[model samples]
Target: MLTKDELCIQKEKPNIKDISLELYKEFSEEILFNQIFVYYFTNGTTMRIEFREWRIYHMLAIQHINGKIGKDRFFSAIENGLTLSDFTINDSIKNRYKIYKERITMFLCMYSALKEANVFYLPSGKVQNTKNAKADYIVFSEIGSKGMNIGLMKSGEVFVPMTILISKPSNKMVYLEDAIPMEVERLEIINIPIKEKEQDSEQ
Candidate 1:
């Protein structure tokens, strides 16, 4: 069984490779970087923008799929918070994560496309000053990040295990695009939406 929120999220997960191919053909590095900036790097503290972007994007991806927030609301909040610099930078200090984890969901989408298009990353890690990993991307386990079960085949194809969060655990890799649940009964919540604002107004 899966929750209704999870089902909604599963339906929205995109095909990464297909998106990679399309974006690679039609975009520039600056455009991709801007998406990274607004969605992932805007609210970061104690880290340089260039360094924090990748990790934040990964966090956003995990959190987004887990039903913490939607892609539209996340970016829309950012735009509403920061309307200057033509949205190249965010100026709002408050509401960084209101009803949202870290204002993300577009990190890997743009990352896959940029990597496929040969748009490169900074050579050194910004936080530690060491050389970053020599792979296409690296994963970080931060607060609120979820684990994605992935395996690589000898043929160079990647397999991702797809299972409902609330269902009995299964290590089954049933399909290539297995990030979302395609077959699971959904459970709907029966109450007022649980946000701090709603709770506060009830008193």
Candidate 2:
């Protein structure tokens, strides 16, 4: 059951509990006592969605960006899941999702690749140091997307649950804390889409 604070939602949070529960139920029937959803956020992060029962944490980064509460088709598509807006050869628009499955997969790979490259480049810590690198640095090249940022990953820091918030409007290359769910939502049956092509155009 969800609490009042969870339901209050202040027009700022997204009420995804119902959908989450539906997913949870499906998961339970498929696999006993399984209650979790995959969550994504700005910045490079992913986490096992939990049902702690709260409103603020119930919302996803997409909902926060799009002005939560809209019946528009675009949003309806997004709420389904944040997949890239791709039209298939069959002339069908891709299923929308709150999280981009392709993006998540690529992000994991890019993160690893960046770490390895950085470690090799700055083994002396003068060029780069994963533990304590200054944000003042910038990677200048026609490399990845302009918005892609290399954030600080600390030792013993549990990061999978954190959303990767890229502060673009701030005119800075970075990913910072936008919000943290006091309680993450849980669901029974989340129809995570079939894995699509590993790449999305326009990054």
Candidate 3:
């Protein structure tokens, strides 16, 4: 049984052979997960995506910056407005907006990947099972000794997961997993292709 928020391993298990020990050692260290731009590909199309900046937290920051939301009220909004109520942004976190933004973008990438795979994350973190349902997958970023760890989970098991290492900032597994390629003949930005300019050969 797979919950809508969860996913099973891909059918093409052949594509996911055990990573070499050398490769594993190479990425053993913590990689900075703060890359603002995420590159995604679908149906033979690739695009660069950036996270939307206008979030509730960003709004609170703006309010704080302008003195609209005072310290106590801003903290209240964070505690009440966000789902992860246990952890609120403190002064230490506030000073590191770049790191916070990176973390936010990481989740954005994870959600986008799950959506592309036709999997949905439930607002409530409860796992459920259905009969004869096509199993789906879950992608999540974990904070580890080595910055962020991206995991691919299937059927209560983790088949392919990687520690994001600064040595190799772009992990192909993050993009390639569960993406069914098609005959899409264009460079896509979030699935929309940019119009190209025609050249005059005679010039």
Candidate 4:
């Protein structure tokens, strides 16, 4: 039986229609359970979709248990899992795991659908302020018989770019927000299945 928290998480799960029914059908819970990493491709350009670490979900459950029922009770609940019927501890663990799994599933589905669509780079990480920083790629937009340079800003730590920009001849900069409207593209599902050992290591 699903706990209240698990039910809530399921209710908020991403819609399969948003990505596409065909893509969603490509992946199964058994397949996604074995995946270690997933990449999203727009046109030909690629970016890694950050998967929520299992440690984060585990830590969230720990925090919830500690805050709600205290550390001693948390340990007690763990030791007495067979007999104790504490909903708080069970719900927290179940809820966090549900979120962790759903996010990975959504990304995989979206990537499969968008892999062949028009490429628009989505930069990741912090914005660098150094002149020496080089852009991974430059996109051009035509305006009034002139071509304008749009640079992809990359972070020093991560190779993937996250933001879009518009540069004009007059040195004016236009920053585009990361929110891609739902209507922009229909997404599909793709899976990168890994060995059981590798999946266990990730957890």
State the C-alpha lDDT per candidate. Answer: 0.25, 0.27, 0.28, 0.32
The deviation in Å at residue 27 for candidate 4 is 13
Task: List the candidates ranked by lDDT, beginning with the highest.
Answer: 4, 3, 2, 1
The 10-residue segment of model 3 with minimum total lDDT is: 25-34
Could you estimate the TM-score for every candidate? 0.19, 0.22, 0.22, 0.28
Badly placed stretches (over 4 Å) of model 2 are 1-64, 67-82, 86-109, 115-147, 153-203
What are the clashing pairs of model 1? Answer: none
lDDT of 3 by residue, 31-136 (tens): 1111122223344333332222122234223332333445334434443453222133565445544333333323323333323332222222222232221212
Best by lDDT: 4
How well does candidate 4 match the true structure in TM-score terms? 0.28
Model 4, global lDDT: 0.32
| Candidate 1 C-alpha lDDT tens digits along 1-203 | 22222322332233332232123212222232222211122223111112122233233442333333343344433334522122222333223433222223222232322222211122231212123312222221111233222111111232111111111124212121213222212212222233532464366
**What TM-score does structure 3 among the candidates reach?**
0.22
Instruction: Summarize candidate 2's per-residue lDDT along 64-178 as a digit string, tens digits.
Output: 3333334234334444663333222133222323342222222222222222222111122221323343322121111233233332222232211222222233443232223
